[model samples]
Target: MSNRRDVWITGIGLVSSLGEGPEAHMQALSSGTAPVVDATGFAPYVVHPLAPISFDAQIPKKGDQRQMEPWQRIGTYAAGLALDSAGIKGNKDILGTTDMVVAAGGGERDQSVDGAILTEIESQPNPEIFLNEQLQSNLRPTLFLAQLSNLLAGNISIVHGVTGSSRTFMGEESSGTDAVRIGWSRIAAGTSEIALVGGAYNAERRDMLLLFALKRLAMHAPWAPVLAQPRGVPTGSAGAFLVLESPEHATARGAKPIAKLSGVWSERAQRNEPGAVEAVIEALINQARGDVTEGTAILSAASGAPEPTAAEVAVLARSGLPVRSITDRVGHGLEAQMPVALAIAALAVSQGSLFAPLEGEPLEKPFTETLSRAIVTGVGHWRGEGVALVERAD
Candidate 1:
């Protein structure tokens, strides 16, 4: 482990309900203002809406923007921001070989078409035949193609000129953790010099809200801090990406690292089994704790789901470190949660400070000392669990 190559976070592209870019997020975090939440837009179900953005800034081509669904557009836009942040946006030499890994969910559904089919199917004499005909006639070929998870990576390659090997994962929150894990591991093992990694989520979609509501996982009350909320998630729209490079690669390119990604560990626990979630989280935290130093804090991506959040809270409480929950500020981003947590951790480490507590929650105390490192943890609402260590670069 001592001889392994060091991985550095050289660039970050983050967009959320707070805003776009590192500066915007830093400002929001420093202000200690209430997170922007929309409790009325979706009615009882609260959500953190995406801040207003002009897609033209990152994606210049109208044709390209027209073809992508909302999630793809968000991811591609963030990918462009990452390349630009690394000072390699138009530099074909670097981008031509930059490995790409993306975490994504299925594409958006055409609600109007779906509604119409459901309404007409009830009247048809032979409902099965009618449904089949409607499916073949109403759905566009492009829509199905757009639904493929890899299109986010494809769009990034087309618009940003990132032509290296591409890999896409698709298991909700777990996918995001694994994507970052793979990117950091590749650089650490000398399998790749630099990589672009992240994911995006669009919570404004009715289809997604319906899906979560079916499982009783969507919040349907007034907005509150994540820990204060009951057994459900206040989903948000966000796109987060990071550019990771081997220390030698970053130094050779004159790229300054924002933070050092020392270690990343991921696991899955049988939530049905009592204490399984807590056990896995505790083990992961202990593994990363070896790198903890003075002024270290935790940035937790604890989805507001009751079971996993309780498990995470318990483990974090025992760690005896000042902790802050990312979901409180950005809302639960599902597949984008881990990358967003990692991005914020890097931002905090680079600035040598932690953000103010959310609503002065007892668990999140004020940290007045200079922050030297951060342990970012993600406990998926249902399945995955992960921990990562990020330290200030020397």
Candidate 2:
């Protein structure tokens, strides 16, 4: 913590099933309507699909769109949105020095190619040889190129012109948590001035559903609020990115901060012992010096999986704060979950009001007064735990 500079959230870009931008999400939340969920398409699994968005608005060039995978496109577009929100989209001077940190996962799998391989391997006597040979002969270099986790940052640099230091973090929810954490840490420590940070997850794919289902983590037909019961995760398609800048830097540019990113802390606890996740959450909250006072809400990225979700809710019980399970509306976005929560928290703090109570979750109380502070927590389905605090800039 070098001199401890204030980290301001100057820009936020969030696209989820609820809709796009701050206004769309605020409207959906104020209405307290049941979120959009797709049950029949994935059959047994319920997923919050990405809302209809025109890629041309952000990714502009056809050449850029064609060269990327769905997740990469999603990330790139979100990154552009963040840059635009920061009021520095075309400023080559600032962009040349702006650092970026992205939380991302491996690219989406090509189901057709995967299907072909599986089908053909089923009949081959030497399946290993056939599989290896087929992979070597049929897999295009372009496939691997799309799978690069850093492509989100690369594409952002290409399309948005954020030509600065870049980093990509993997490992699902924790990765999202740490992306902002590192961004804040660097800016606060004076190691960097302005930075672009966040992630995107296109969970509307069969591969993503299959991966979650394998762990018995898919929510079926009767979709309910995340904390309504001990439920499985309903995957969501979303992309979220935020622009963080130091107080001095933002003020110099005449950029008004929406909220101040006060603190960020994350951890991974061993799940072999019961109550371990709860302990991790407590420690992380303590680290952030998170306030759980009245007029504050907990924007929990509870992923909706039983093990960690239960433990996390148990810990949050001590806070006695109004809680909102964001995934209930936006669904579970692995890499983008925590950052999106932070963005929503910033919006709530700035607007001075909490959203309507989450339906089906009786304990998720609604605060009628203006919102002042938000404590955002991320509990990974199986592993990491993180906590962050955002408050009104004023």
Best by lDDT: 1
Off by over 4 Å in 1: 140-147, 291-293
- Residue-level lDDT of model 1, residues 257-356, one tens digit each, is 9999999999999988999999999999888887555799999988888888888888988999999989889998898999999999999999999999
Question: Could you tell me the lDDT of residue 210 within candidate 2?
Answer: 93
Q: In candidate 1, which residue pairs clash? A: none
**What is the TM-score (0 to 1) of candidate 2?**
0.95
Clashes of each: 0, 3
The TM-scores, one per candidate, come to 0.97, 0.95
- Compute the lDDT of residue 64 as modeled in candidate 2: 94
Candidate 2 residue lDDT tens string, 92-206: 9999999999999887677888899888889999999997787688755555443589888899999999998998999889999999999999999999999999999998899
lDDT of 1: 0.90
